[model samples]
Target: MALSLCCAWISILLLLLPSLSHGGKLLVVPMVGSHWLSMQEVVEKLSERGHEVVVLVPEVSWQMETTQAYKVVTHPVSQTLEELDNSFQEYVAVHLTQKPFPLNALAMYNTSVHVFNSFFGQCKDLFRSQETLRFLNQSGFDALLTDPAFMCGTILAHHLSLPFVFFMRGFPCNLHFAAPQCSSPLSYVPRLFSFNSDHMTFFQRVENTLISLLELDYCNGFYGEALKLSSEVLQRDVSLMDLVNSAAIWILRFDFVFEYVRPVMPNMVFVGGINCAKKKPLPKEIAPSLLNCGHAISLHNVCELEGWDFSFLFQISLMLFDRLMESPLNLINKAKNNILNKNIRIKLYLRHSITSGPRRVGAGLRFKRQILAGSTI
Candidate 1:
C-alpha cells in the first residue's frame, strides 16, 4: 500500500511540473507605433504556454478582458494619428532634398532629432503617470520585454527595479547599443539612413563615417529633456542610458544572410524571419517559365520588379541574356557561346530591397564588366 501511494504521488507531481515552472507574470511594453503584430505574437505564445502576460499598449485595437492567459492595459494618448503621419512625411522630404546642399549632415541630424522629440514627447503622460507607475510597481511582474527604440520603456523598467529584455521588431540598426560603445567599425557597416551597401569605396567609407557621427549626435541630443522627465517620474535621478545598457538580452529581427558580416556580443541574439510563413505554390502563369529554365541568377536585394517582367524574361532566354550584357559582359559573351551549343546554365537569386535596381545594374556594369572583359575565356 505504501509503495502504491508513493507511485501515485509521483504521477501527480509530473502533471503539476509544467504549470509550476511556467507560472510567472510577464510584462511587455512595445513602441507606440504601427506593425506591432510581431510583439503581439510573442505575447500570445507566452500566454499559450501558461505564463500570464500583461501588455501595456497606447491604443487598444481589441476589447480588453481578463482571461486565464493574459490581460491588456490601454492608455490612449492625446495626439491625433494625422500628426504622426505628417511628421514621417516631413522626415522623408528632408532626406530626399538633402543631396543638393552641402553640410547636409547637420541639416539631417537637426531634422531627425526634432521629429523623434515631438513623437516621444507625446507619450509623456503614459510613461510619467503617477497612477500607471503605482500600478506597475504593485503588479509583481517577473521581468520586462520592451523595445529600446523609445527610452521610456527603459526608464520604466529602471523605476520599477525590474530586469529588462529587448525585442526589436524591426531592422537592427542600433548595434552600437548592443555591442561595446564605439566597437562597431564605421569603415564598412552602413548607417541606418545611408543607402550604401556593405561594400564601400574609399570615398564612401569617409561619407559613412560622417553619417554615423551625425546619427550618434542626433540620438543623444534630446537626452537632457528625457533625463529631466524620467527623473521627475521615478522620484530619483536615473541614468537612462545605463538602464538600457544593463539589458539581460537583446533579440534582433534580422537574418545573417541579409546583413553584413559583423561581430556581435554574447548577449545579442537573432530570431530573424519570425513572421515568415511557408511558401505557397507558384501561380500557373509563372510556373511554366521556370520549369525548364537554364542557369538562373537570383539577385538578392534588388528593387521590386513587375511579375510580368520576370515571366517575360524566362520566356525568351535570349532576352534574359540581353539584360546581363551591360555588366558581367563576359558572362553575356560566355552565355552567347552556351546558347549556340544549347547548354546555358546560370542561376541568379536577387535578395530584397537592398537598393534601387537601376543603381545595382549600373554599378555592376561599371565594375564587373571591366574585370571580365579582360579575361581570355
Candidate 2:
C-alpha cells in the first residue's frame, strides 16, 4: 500500500508540473553601475532558462550591445555616466586621503544627491520619449524586474501598471522601503550611509536617528521634483511613496551574517554571493602551488595577507549556508535542496573542503573585528 501511494504521488506531481513553471516575458530596467552588473547576470540566466528578457537601458557610450541572449532597447539619455563616475572618484580620493577616520556626512549626502539628481533627470527624459512609451505598453511583458538605485524603475513599473520586483544590490536602508515595508527598526538597523555597526553605543543610535531624519528630508525635497516631472511626462497623478511601498518583492544581495541582527519581512529575501561562479578554474599561478602543498588550506574571502607580499599557498572560496530567493515556489524549494545537498553528490571536489570541526577561537572573530574597526562608532 505504501509503495503504491508513493508511485501515485509521483504521478500526480508529474501531471501538474506544466502549471508549475513561472517563466514568462520579463522586462528589466537597470541603473548603470558596477553594482548593477549582477542584474545583467540575472537577465542572461533568465533568458537561458527560456524566459523572454527585454532590457530598456540608457543609450550611453559604455553600454553593452544587444545580443542573442536578451533583447535590448535603448532610449536617448540626457546626462553622461562618465561625468558622474569621475565626480564620485574625485570625492572618494579627497575623503580617503584627507580625513578617513570620521566620515564627512555632508560630503556623502551632497555627492549622493548630485549623482541621483542627474540620473533622475535622464530617466525623466527616457519616460518622455515616444519610443519608450511604445515599448512600455506594447511589450506584452508579464513582470518587471528593476534596480531601485534611483527609483526611476519604480516609477516606470507603476506607470506601466505592472507587478515589479526590486533587484537591490544591497540594503539601501531607505526609510520609505525598509521601515514601512519591512518594519526594519532604526534603533538597531543602521542606515546605509550612516557608517555605523549593528551594535551601537547610545550616542551612535542618536547619530543614526539624525542621519535617518536628514535622509528623509533630502528624499522628500528631491522626490518632490521627480513627482512633478513624472506627473507631467505620464500625464497622470501618482504618489512616489505609494509606488515604492507597492513593491511585490525585494531581492537583497547580501547575507544575514554580513547584516545587522534585525527582523526582515517575508518579502525581503537575501541571496548572498549568488554572483560568484559555481566552478571557477584555478589561476595558473596558484594551481601549481596547490598540488605541491601537502595540506590544502581553504581561506574564505582572504585574498591577501596583511603584511606578506609573497605568493601564498592558501586557496580562497566563499561558501554560505542560506536560502536563495527565486520565483516559482517549487523551483526555489528544489534549488535549495540542490545547494545544500551538492557536497554529497560531488566527491573529488570535497578535497578542498574546510574542516567542519569547531575551532579553538570563536567563529568569524576576524570578520567581526574588521567590521567593528571599520564602522564610525
Candidate 3:
C-alpha cells in the first residue's frame, strides 16, 4: 500500500514539472494565521506566470461568526490570538504601573493552545467544508499545497487520490527528529527541545523546547485525534500521516525556505521561498526567536502587550501604503475637476467683463464719429 502511494506521488510530481512548463493550475489551501496572507503572493504570482491558481482559504472569504466554523478556528487561532492581544494590554498595564515585567512564554503559549484546539477538533464539519469538497471534486487541481497546521491538506489529497505535496509553512519542532512523530510532548516542553540552532544561548534553547511542548499538547488533544477520524470520514484507514509526513522515501516536503536556513534532511527540502521566485522578507515586527524558536515564531523583546502580530502589522503597513498611494491620485483628480468646472469659466468671463475699460473699438464709436464729422462738414 505504501509503495502504491509512493508510485502515485512519483507520477504526479513528475507531471508537476512538465505541467508547469505548459501551464498548470495550483490549488492551495491557506492556514488561518500569519501564513494565511503570506500565501496570497504565491497564488498571485503563479497566476501571473501563466498558471491558474484558486486559493481556498478558511477565513479569507468568510466573516466572523459564532457558528460551527467560528468555534472550530477561534479556539486554536484565538488562544494564541488572545495572548497576542493581551501582550498589548500588558504593555499598557506596565506603562501605567500594571506589572513590572511583561507576560512571558508560559502564559502566551497556554492562551494560544487553548484557542488553537477549539476549532482544530472539527474543521471538516465546520461551515462550507462540503462546499469546498464539492468544489474540489470538480476543480481538477494540478498541484496541492497546504500548511500542516491543519491536517486537512493530507486529508484532501487522500480522499481525492491526487498527487500529494506537503508543506510545513514554518519550521518543524523536531529539527532532526529522533522520531518521525514530532508531536511528542517532550518536543513542546520548554528547555527540553533543541531546534538545530548551535548559536542559541542556553536559555533561548530552553524556551524553544517549552514552545515545542505546547505544540505537542495541541496536536495530541486536537490535531492527532482529528486526523484519526479523517480515515473514518474518508472510509479507509489510510495512514494520513504518510501524506502528512513522508509516506514514501522519494516524496516531497515542500518547505523550501524558512527564517534560518538550517541544514535539513534531503527528505525535507525548504521550498518555501520557491513558490515565488524571489523572497518575501519577514515583517519588522519579526525578529529572531530564542530556544526551539522554530521558523514559525519570530519573537522580538517580549515587551508587554502590543495587540498585533507581526503579520497584522505588515497588513496595516500595506493598507497605509495603499491609502498613501491613492492620495496623489485623488489630488490629481480634484485638480482635473477644478480645471473642467464650467463655473470657473463663467467666473473668468465675469472678471473680463468687469475689467473692461472703455472698449478700444465700440459699436457706437464709428457711428458717433461719422455723425460728428458730418455735422462739422
User: Whose TM-score is greatest here?
Assistant: 2
Candidate that scores best on lDDT? 2
Instruction: Tell me the tens digit of each residue's lDDT in model 1 across 1-377.
Output: 99999999999988878553556888888765433555666777888878888888665222233445568776756766666666655665565453543456556656676666766764586774567767888999999988766666777787788898888843224543433343556777777656678788898888888866665445556455566777786787755456567888888766655666766778777777574322234447644664444444443322233232432334344334334322232221112111111211233323244443322111111112222222221
- Residue-wise C-alpha lDDT for candidate 3, range 1-377, written one tens digit per residue: 99999999999988777443567866665565445544555556666777766655444222222322111222111224344334334432222222222244334434434544444434554323665577677978777766656666656666776665544544233422322443323322333223335366667666666566564454454445455667676776644344455422112234423233334445554444344343333344432222233322222332343443443443433443333232222111111111211111100111111232421110100111212211211
| Cα lDDT for residue 92, candidate 1 | 53
Which runs of model 3 end up more than 4 angstroms from their true locations? 1-21, 59-109, 119-122, 126-131, 175-218, 236-240, 247-263, 267-377
Writing each residue's lDDT as its tens digit, candidate 2 over 1-377 gives 99999999999998978765667998898877655566778888999999998888777734466689999888887767666555555444444333342356555556666656766777877877987888678988888999777777777887788899988764233743453455556788787656787788999898888777776566666566567766775688856566577888888776666555666778887877665524445567655665454433343333333432211211222111111111111211111111112111101121111333222111111112222222321
Pairing residues by index, what is the TM-score of model 3?
0.44
Deviation from truth (RMSD, Å), model 3: 26.0
Ranking of models by TM-score: 2, 1, 3
| Model 1 vs truth, CA RMSD | 11.8
- The TM-score values for the models, in the order shown, are 0.62, 0.67, 0.44
Which 10 consecutive residues of model 1 have the lowest summed lDDT?
332-341
Distance from true location, Cα of 65 in model 3, Å: 18
